[model samples]
Each structure stands twice: as structure tokens, then as C-alpha cells.
Target chain A: MSRPTRTTEESIARVLPELDYSKIALSLVVMLFFAFFVSPIWTGLVTAFKTTGAVTATTPFVPVLPGTEGFTLAKWTRAIGYLSTGFVNSLAMTIPATIVSVFLGSTAAYGLTLVDWNERLQFGILILFIAGIFIPYQAVLVPLSDFWINLVPLVDILAPVWQLPFLEPDHARLLSLTITHVVYGIPLCMLLFRSYYLTLSDELVEAAKIDGATISRIYRRIILPLSKPMIGVVFIYQFTAIWNEFLFSLTLIGSSSSPAATVTLVLSGMGVDLSGIDFGFRMAGAFVAAMPTLIIYVLFAEQFARGLAEGNT
Target chain B: MAGSQDTATGSRTIGGGETDWRTRVETFSKSDFVRSFPYWFVPFSLVGMGVYGGIGWNTVISLTDYEGFDRPDYTNLDFSMYAQALSDPWVYLTAKNTLVLLIAFTTITLVLGLLLSILLDRGIRYKEKIQTIYLLPMALSFVVTAQFWLWMYNVNNGLVNAVVGVFGLGPFNWIGNPDLVLGAVIFALIWQYSGYAMVVFLAGLQAIPDDQFEAAHIDGAGVFKTYWRVIIPQLKSSSVSAAVVLMVFALKAFTFLYAMFGQYRVPKATDILATLMVREAFMLQHWAYAAAIGTILLVMALAVVAPYLWYQYGQGSL
Candidate 1:
């Protein structure tokens, strides 16, 4: 079926103007737009390699000429050194949060779909979850901060847990931020998972039930295997989201002074404090902070796009 | 055995009033709703307590004169903080900024994205690669983008100045100058999210059947006319969903501004309600006033989102 359609499309393409003037102009327009879109990233990449003196001495768009004093890795080294703690903190918070939220969200979505409950009640509950996606974090920020601050005493009460051989002092703040991400993240994850789950054939679920499969067994045997693609999409989406998050970390973990500062908070702090830092170091820090998401986007661009598109749907 | 007992009890319930309540309760316990409770209860409770509960707490705090670590006086709760906010000039200024940001950002991004999607839809080569290039920025943290743009907007030796210099424009202080700061911030935000709008529009464009385009062509309609008249009109839903998402992001532009300025007091020109709310609560310790401002921001966000939700629900896609 697709073969005949492909041939028709090819014939159409062949009959059309192969290299018309308008086509050339349109391509040029797109190229220029892409160039403008990528200029900042290009500037940051080139600037990251330039020496501090060269960064100020030359225009931002100019590349650092190799075999000259312009090029150096000193800035990268310093940035990594300064950002190491933040990198660890961010990973410690983001990984567990992403995993836990996706797990909870998937289970809830599966459960919501498996039952033959009242239609209006199900939708009302679905809206309750979906509404979280819209509630401006600002609405919850004051109480959220108060809640965390109040929990510090509880952390003290559980100090013995903190002193466990596996734990550190900063673990309290990291754990709190992780929990915050999970809480905020559940709605989005559930929305994505539920949308995917709804696409599933209800007869398959009914068959499993008739076969005496428990809810957990059906979920484990059927849904989990089919959910791989969706899990990828949601994982990438939530991972980048939690990693890129700033407000929650800034509000909950305080500042760079705190041992629990995420990479975003530290990077922002680096941008502000220009006392001895140069543009080279700042750009390097920005790139370093952005590397994980950038790598994910480069590797999984299709999944990333699908995640955004499906998220809105 | 349980099913037999249930039927027996159910029949008896129909004949006897005393057993009716107990049987109904038993049936309710065995219903799907109760059976599925284990799956959804955890997430439901977490979001309920974290999001809904926080909003409730925030609203309660807003009613009191809460500030500077003094415990809130719940006994004398009222709308005094809101009244104070109403009288404050900064509130109006930030509100104006927020509205401007919401409208300008959403409109420009939508148009630009629509244009890109249309252009790409014309069978452009290397389309996916180009789309990814455009979209790569959206994946980065706001702090990273803010820092990158801060450099790009630097008065001296920055790319913006360099490009404008060729056109004989003065090197503008994009960040420091109050008159230009809001526009500058909006432009950077557009840079980050226009790609997202483009992707959404692209999906919408792809969903348009090829027959529609051919039909328009056969009717002697030009490419521009075909899109402007038929294709674009069909994209109303796409435009709406993208616009709502963009508007919500605009309301959250506090992250970008805060990262750029690294302070609660962002420039007055660029201060939206988000920044104002944070400043009031965290910096000045005007907790109640900030909560009031947050409530107002929440209402504004809902004003933008509620219609979209309603539309989705009406479409049975909720």
C-alpha cells in the first residue's frame, strides 16, 4: 500500500520544478532562521574555549583561533571544580525523584484506566490530577517553603537516621527537594501516562481479568512491556524538567551557600558573582550545567519532541 | 460462596429495610472504585496535600497579617493584605508587566512558530535535523539560557550589539536599561520557546490531510492563500493549546528573570507578578502581602488555563 503512494509522491516531486528560484529563496530563509536560532549556543560553545583575556578582547561570535593565546581549557577546569558539588546534589535529587514520580504516576494512571468506575467521577478525579499542571507554583511557594522549614525540626528529631553510615547532613535538604519534585511532578507524569494508557485496548485488560490475573499481575505482565516507549518519553521529559528546575531548588534548598544547592542554583550564582570570574568561566559553567540535557536531546530528539507534543495533547 | 451470600443479602435487602444499609455498604466495598483505590490513592493524596493543601494554606496566610517570622494571627483574619496590595503602586506595575509579557510572548511566539512550521511543511530537506536544532534550547535549564542571553545582550562585545552595529544602531544596554529590559527579556524567552510552538504547529500541520492542500491547489488558490484561509483555520485547536502552554510559561518567567538578575528585586521594568511575589515573601518578608499577590497570579493563570481545560473537557479529551 505504501509503495504505490511513495511512487506517486516521487512522480509528483519529479514533475515539480526541481530547483526553482522560489525554492532556493525558501531554503535560504529557513537556513538563516536556523542560523539565528543557533547563534547563542554557537556563541556559548566558542566562548567556552576562549581564554578570559580573549573572551573580552574579541567579539562573541568570533571563534578562538587555535595555536594562539585565545584558546584554553583552564575555564572548563575551574567551572567543573566549582560545580562538582552542585552536580552531585542535582543528580542526588533528580534521579530518585524522576524514578519515583514516574512509577507512582504510571501505577495511578493504569489503575484509573483499568476500572469501570462512574464516568463523571473518573473524569473529576482526572481533572483533580490535571489541575495541578496549571496551578502556578507561586500559589504554593509560600506554604511550600513554610512546610519545608517546619520539617527541619522533624529532621532533627530523626537525627539518628541522618547519622546513619549511609547518610550525610545535606541528605535532609536533598531528600526534601526530591520529595518536592516528586509531588509536583506526579500530575504531569500521570497525565502523560494516562493519555498513553487510554490508547490501550480495553478488551486486552478484560481478557486478562477473565484469565484470573490480578490487577498487579496484568500491569506487570502486559502494561509494563508496552509502556517502554511511553516510559522513555516521560522519563526524558521529567528528567530534564527536574534537572532544569530552579525555583523549587532555590526556594527549598536556599542558595549556593547551602550544601544542597542544585546545579541551576550554583550556575545562577556563578552568573551573578563577577568579582574575579570572566565571561569564559561563566559560559563554561553554563555549558557544564546544560550538558546532561543537551546530551539527552541529541541522543533522543524524537522522544523529546513526542514528549512535548503529547504533553500538550 | 461470597457471591451467593451477596445475592442472598441483596434480595433480603430489597425485602427488609434493616438489612438494606448493611448490604449496600458491602456492595460498595467490593466495587471497582474501592478495588482500584490502591493504585491511585498515593498520587491522589500527595498532589492533594502538596498542591491543594498548599494553596489552602497560602490563602489562609494571605488573610492574616503574617510577616517576618511572627506567627500568623488567624483569630483576626481578613482581607487587609489584599486591601494593602490594591493600594500599592508596585502591584499595578507588576500586574501590567505580567499582562504585557503574557500577550506579547504568546502572540509573537505563535506567529513565529506558525511561520516556521509552514515553511518546514513545504517539504524542506533535513527537516528533522533543523527542527531539533531549533528545539535544542528548550531542553536546557533556564539558568543556562538566562546566562547565555545575558552575555549575548552585553553592552560591549556582545552579539546583539555586534549585529546592530552593522546596521548603525547604538550598542544598547539590553538588561540594565529599564525601557528596553522587558522587551529584551521577552525576546530571549521567545528564543527559548518559539521552537516549542513550532513543533506543536508542525504536528498540527502534519495532521492536515494532503487532499485539503490538493483541493485548494486545484481551485487555483496560491500557497499563501491556501494556508491563510483553509489550513490555518483548521489549526485553531493547535494554536489554543500552544498559546495556553506559552502563556503559562510566561507567568513562570520569574525563573529566567531571577536567574538573570540573581536577586529578588529584578529591574522594575521587567518585574512581573512572579518576581514581585517572591520579593515580597522571601526578600522583604511581607508574607501575607506576597501570598495575596500569589493568589492574584493564580487567578490570572486560571483565567488563561480554565478555558483550555473546559475546551478539552468538552471535547472529551480531559
Candidate 2:
């Protein structure tokens, strides 16, 4: 949809009247308002000090400050034992998936907007990508997962390069999950890139072409360099999305007792197995596992702002 | 190859024609490849074809009983799955919960985002820093935020209890008990998403000129009247934008619930449709039944959103 266009005269004339004060009073209620985000888990960071009795003693209440004045690393030590392998498993899933999806997504977007492809083919693929967004992952998970498991043999036979990184070939299960996540991310990546690309002058692209730059070379030498901000934004979006993914990892890795699981699957396992329901440790583990995403946010806030701003959703 | 050799022999430059022919062949191949990029790019369109085919198939899948690798018995399938999914007290309750969370989160996020945008617009000092800090959660994944909150919401050692301890209150069961689980999840959503909505509103607010506010000020227009009669109406698009996004997010929330509540949390209590479909169908392997729930969910989302989309389209056309 087009952005609504308003004339300056109309804009001023409309605002000729003032607004109500009480209408936005809640805005000024900083303590209570900010509390919405902060209050929910405000004391979680400090609660690392309390003994288990002191913890469970509160029943369901979270302590703003635990009774134990001194800190204890017991939870940390225990958490490592509980979730370390899971953390490695999750990383193994996220890192490669994030890299591949970002590459494929940008390529699709570039091809659609910058490179001239058949018009119907362009929209067809674009729509294909878009349509996947609305379909719940659950609807496709079963067939899709099975499709991945089934793909292992075919990939080995047809695309041997896929075998180089995938030595076991059985681990193609992870690659299957990766493909699905990548496929899901395609539309969004294309939408973001194409929108941003629209803002760039075609003269720039033509200029690069005049210098005898190959299509791929022009993309690397020119477009890629110019698109750093958007790249950062895409990176953050994909990083968080792929990193925090739960179900695929759970199904592929966690459900089996092959002594392997992604962090999400393990973290989920924590929730499942929690008879005492270790909220403190579980939450801690969740945060620790999610640290990479948090770090990306802190590091690249601007990229996220610009990138998400143009998200087609 | 022979024709190129004949041209080389006919070259007035004699034997040097061979070198020229080689160069000509090299340039021709290079240019031909360059000119043929449009063809080389065809394979990539497969991604789109794959996507579109997926859409068609998913639509069909939603309607059928084809569960994963299991052979489907579509003939036996009717509205049984859909009816059961809809009739299930849990589905109904979760639908209600979903609606409540959508409204609460959207309303809260929209209001706060609008206010934050306006506050920053009014030239709040350190505006940029606050904006970044606020937007930090938006950048963080839902899973990360959920996990972070899972820690923060921990009863025994959670920061909430620690803070409340001085006030002489016990730690509340944030994710554990069914009573507060929905609220906890909602809080998690707001924390992560409000900043996202705020940035959108802020961008819209930026596009709004200062002259309008100034004119309202000179006209004896109080802040409220200016905002109510002027600002609010103008922000209709932004409001719709925020509402639409928040609604979709609430509807699609899986990671948050799954991370916090686990798969089997009492179905009716905290189970959103997305999670319910997977929990029942995939986890429980109730293939036909889960497919039914998924179909219902697809219908529900479209039923709720399709109207708004059409309405937006009509308004845009006008």
C-alpha cells in the first residue's frame, strides 16, 4: 500500500485545535509505565544469590532482592552441566542456518529488484516467499520434517557438495531444518532488500556495470558495500530469528535421546521436566542461551531500526 | 570451430589471425554469457515457484488429513477435526486468551509507542539513547526475551521476588501456574514488541510536521485538543499499522509460550492455537486432529484479518 500523502495546508488546518491532557497522562507515568517491561522480571538478575529454600519459600513471588546477601555460582555451575551440550547443539543449528538464509534471501531480493529477470517469474517467486509467512509452521512441519529426512539420500546422490560439510549425512536433518527456516525467511528478506534497493539510484548500478563488472562482481563490489546498513539489519533479524528457533530443533534434536539437543530443545526440556519448576535457573539458562541475540541488538540497534522499519508485514 | 579457422586463414594479417580468432572466441563467449544472464537467473526463480507451490499445497493441506508421511484418508475426513478443534474447551479458551492478549498487548504497546514517539517529538533530552534502549528488546528474538524473562520471573531466585521481598511479598509463580501464565507471556510480548511498534509510530510522527503543532498552539489549542482532534486522527494509519502487526504477532506467538509454558501445559489455560496445533498433532502425533486445528486456525486468522485487509485496500483505492 502507498503511504498516505497529506498537504501541508491540510495538515496545519487539521491541527488547529489542541489535544487533551489526560489523553496521554499515562505517558508521563514513567515508573508505572516502564514497570510494564521492568517489573515482570526486575529482580531476576540479582536472585542468583538466594538458596533454594529461600527461593521456593517465596512460593510464587519473585524476590526483588534475595535474602542471601552473598552471591552463589551454584546455579551457574549446575546450569552448565544441564544445558552446555544443548547450547552447542543450538549454536550448530543457528550459525550455519543464519548465514545461508541471509545469503539466499539477499540473492533472491537482488535478483528480483536489481537484476532483470522475467516479470512473472519475479512476482511468482516473491509471492511464493510471501505466502509462506501466513502459513503456520505447524501445518507444514510434519511433511516438511519428513521431507528433510527423505532428502538426505537424494542430497548425497545428487548434490555431493552438500556431503562435504555434512560428513555423517544423517545430520542432514539439521540441514533440512535450515532449508525450511531459510525458505521462510526468503520473502521477508526480499521485501526488505527490494524496498531499500528502490531507494538507490539505478545510475549507480549502471555505473558499476559500465566498469565491466560481472553481475556477481557488481553485487559484491558495489551493492554489497553500499548495503551495509541493510545488511546489518538483516543480520540482526535473521540472527535472532534463527538463534531463538525452538520447534524445529526440538523435533530434530531434542526429542531424540541421541545425547544431542539444541538449547531451545533443552531449555524446553527444562520446562517439561520441572516438577519443582526451577524458574530462576531455567530463566537464567534461557538468558544465557539468548545472550548472542541480545549482544547483536546492543551492537546494531540502528541496522534493526532501518531494516525492520521497512518490513513488508 | 572450423568456420573460425577458415576466417583465421583468410585474415590479411596471416598467422596472427589465429590469435585474433582466439580473442574473438573468448570475447564472444564472455559477451554471450553476459548477455545470457537473464537465462542464468532462471534457476533462481525456482525459489519463488517453490514458494507459490507451497502456498497452494498448504491451502490444500489445511483442508485435508495428510499428516506428514502418513497416508491420508481424505475420504474419511470431513469437518470432524475442525469441529473438535473449535468445540474443544481449550481451543475456545485459548482463542479467548489470544484475543485478550492481542488487545491488551496492542493497546498497551500502541499507546506507549505513540506516547513515547510524542515525548521524543517534544524534544526529550537523551532522546536518542532512550530510543535505542527501548528498541533493544525489539531487536532481541522472542525466544531470547522469553528466556530472559523466564529467568527474571523465576520465583525462588527471580529478581521480581528479590525486589518484592523487601516489600514482604512472596515470589509469584510467573510461568509455572496456569493462573498467571497468560499474563506472563503477554508481558514478555509487550517487552519485546512495544519498542518495535514505537519505532514505527516514531517514524510516522517524524513525518508529521512541527508546523501543525505550532499552529494549534497559536490558536489557543491545548495539548489534548491538538492531540485528540488533530494528532490522533492523523495517526490513523500508524494506529492501524501497529494494531495489524501486534494482532498478527499475538496470533502467531509460539516461541514465547513454548519457551515458557512447555508443550503440554494445560491445553485450555495457556495454549494458543499455534502451539495447540503442534502440541496435539506433532508432539502428540494426533495427525488428523492437529491438521484440523491448523485448518481452523488458518480460517480463524483469515476470518479476522481478511476483512481488515480488504477494508484497508478499499480506503487506499479511494
Question: What tens-digit string does per-residue lDDT give for candidate 2 at B178-218?
Answer: 78777777767777887777888777777677667767766
User: Distance from true position, residue B267, model 2, in Å?
Assistant: 4.5
Off by over 4 Å in 2: A1-28, A39-42, A54-70, A115-128, A150-170, A206-217, A254-260, A271-275, B1-51, B58-80, B83-93, B139-144, B147-181, B303-318
The estimated TM-scores of all candidates read 0.93, 0.77
TM-score, candidate 2, is: 0.77
Query: Please, what is the whole-model Cα lDDT of each candidate in the order they appear?
Result: 0.85, 0.62
Sliding window of 10 residues with minimal summed lDDT for model 2 chain B? B32-41
Q: Pick the candidate with the highest DockQ.
A: 1
Given the true complex, what DockQ would model 2 score? 0.28
lDDT of 2 by residue, A156-215 (tens): 555665456524444555556666666666656666766777788888867766665666
Q: Write the per-residue lDDT of candidate 1 for residues A219-294, one digit (tens) a residue.
A: 8899989999999999999999999999888887777767778999898888455474477888999999988898
Assess each model's interface with DockQ, reporting 2 decimals per model. Answer: 0.55, 0.28
On the 0 to 100 scale, the lDDT of residue A306 in model 1 is 85
Model 1 chain B: weakest 10-residue lDDT segment is: B1-10
TM-score of chain A, model number 1: 0.91
